[model samples]
Target: MTATALTMLNCHLTIPALYFRGINDMYVRHSRIQHGVGQGSFHSATVEFSATGRHRFDYVFDCGALKYAKLSPEFQYALKRVSLTKRAPGGNKAVLDLMVLSHFDADHMNGAQSLVKRYAVDRIVLPYLGVEELALIIASQADAIDKDTLKELHGLANGVGKLWKRPVTMVKTGPRKTEERVFSDDPQREPPDAERSEPPRTQEFPHPVSVVLESTGAAPGTVMLDEDNLVVGSSSAGRHDTWKLRFWNRGLHATLGEPGIWQDFERHYKRELPQTQTVVVPHHGAAPNAGARFYNPGLNHRPRVNAVISYAVRNSHGHPHPSVLADIAYAGGRLLRVTDDTRLGYQEIYLFRP
Candidate 1:
């Protein structure tokens, strides 16, 4: 696509799509995916069942180690679009509808502060922050971070607090059900009055596609579905043909001291799990994150699903675990790797149809 066409698409239009971007972290890189139909690369994820452009859901997920140098131009394009369209009468509204942190690892969250500093984020989603995690952050960063900057690190430090004044929703797993809490302000009872600043603009470039696009090849040892153009399914009548993207942290059991937390959480979504068109192979396709029961005959109902594995090319952990890949293929799912060799830029799947 030409730069002009890409810019036009980013600013004026919103499409139902998904985008998975590779991360450049040193040891264990991460990736980010957004689902939406907008002209710029930074548009929040959204789902639309029809082409009428009337119905949709605005949301976004995981921010990898994307730098401001790369994201600033897209932000500017979005701002320009908003200015022209009058979508934001006063100024640019929240650029990020939701920021989901799969885990607290630096590779996954290193760009979070930069994201918040650059965009108007509406909400943040993450796994529940427990006392132990907070203690660890404090103990580890106590010397590196000074008292003056400690308060600013509340969200990163505690896993629940304001980032640029945006509310945070922390998900907690339970035996029977999952729970969530919203943190609009400081959880420590201190006033969250950090000054906000605008992200600096740089040379303009087309924002990376925020949504998924069709691909030609499939990863080895997996089956690629041919229904690339199929939108919403017939079963979705009244709903907006939603695409659910879930995140699982490998450290959940360690943090919660409950081995079954992830299992229980999966059980809660079992009914709708099969309907998911794309699954971000949890924990970069770690073995611990994928159990046999998850892909058991009855549980693996989706005839064709995209299993996304976001890992670094030179990963030290040897991610995209063999067992995990086997289970996904056995369950009749395709593998979409976000690494250099795979070059599977972003695997787009149609979530609904008219």
Candidate 2:
């Protein structure tokens, strides 16, 4: 694609269909997850599903850094970079389709308010927590944050709309049957997957495309089926050729008392974990907060799972804990961290259609 053609596509024009046959194609060509570099924790990625080379879903999993100053420039750059291949239609501003606040930790969510104010975010997802749990997370950061910043955080804790005018989805932990729905419009029925005009041929994308994108803390109801694709092997009525991306969040407080939490998250997504090929290690790779089970090699289909860690060098907490490193090594997983190179300040993983 020429630079002009790419620019026109990024602007959401319909000119691509004239030159490319994959304009309406349903299968996911590949997905590239870019981990942003900052002193603290920040993660966001642009998923490209169109064979014609366009990003369909732009999402930010978490945003915040140990140093507040770095958050603005780094996050802005990330936001702009992801928006290059796509922008929400009928809008002058770049659109961020999804924003998931993993937890209320300052390092994980401090940049959200600014982001919401600057960009056009279609939906926001966060773990459902009681007033007490919200208080606990806020209090943990009170000593370090300013009163105004604290107030803004508190506003977000109270209700997402209180701070920003975007819709919010709360994911909670409970029996799989009682999970709350987020991505789907119908609460009772499963969200529709990407549109499939016909069954996928065996020759498409090869066999057993690994990498089950599973989000802990999210219940089965939170599973979002994109309108342009279907699960690779899900028995749903459609061609089983596209990759499945499900979001499940496990609501764990930032404090270190929840060892059994991972188990609950694991059980909630037990049906989908086996196909997992990449794991976005939580809590900046803190063992106590996320545990070693995140790197379970026996269950993950791939020989070497992609273990992505987002943390900064010389951080106060010494993130990407030694234990987490050991867990990845033991599982024979590949460790990719944003801090691996200071100059780039970003790490990426590309998964192509077989």
- Top TM-score model: 2
The C-alpha local distance difference test score for the whole of candidate 1 amounts to 0.37
8-30: candidate 2 lDDT, tens digit per residue: 00000000000001213333433
- TM, every model: 0.52, 0.63
Give the per-residue Cα lDDT of candidate 1 at 182: 21
The TM-score, computed over Cα atoms with residue i paired to residue i, of candidate 1 is 0.52
lDDT (10s digit) by residue, model 1, range 216-319 = 11111111121121111112121122222333333333321134543543453443454445555545555545433222223234566666565555555666
* lDDT scores of the candidates, listed in order: 0.37, 0.45
lDDT at 77 for candidate 2? 57
Task: Name the regions of candidate 1 deviating beyond 4 angstroms.
Answer: 1-44, 49-56, 66-86, 138-161, 174-251, 254-259, 288-303, 341-344, 349-354
Number of backbone-clashing residue pairs for each candidate, in the order shown: 16, 16
Q: How many backbone clashes does candidate 1 have?
A: 16
| Model 2: lDDT of residue 192 | 33
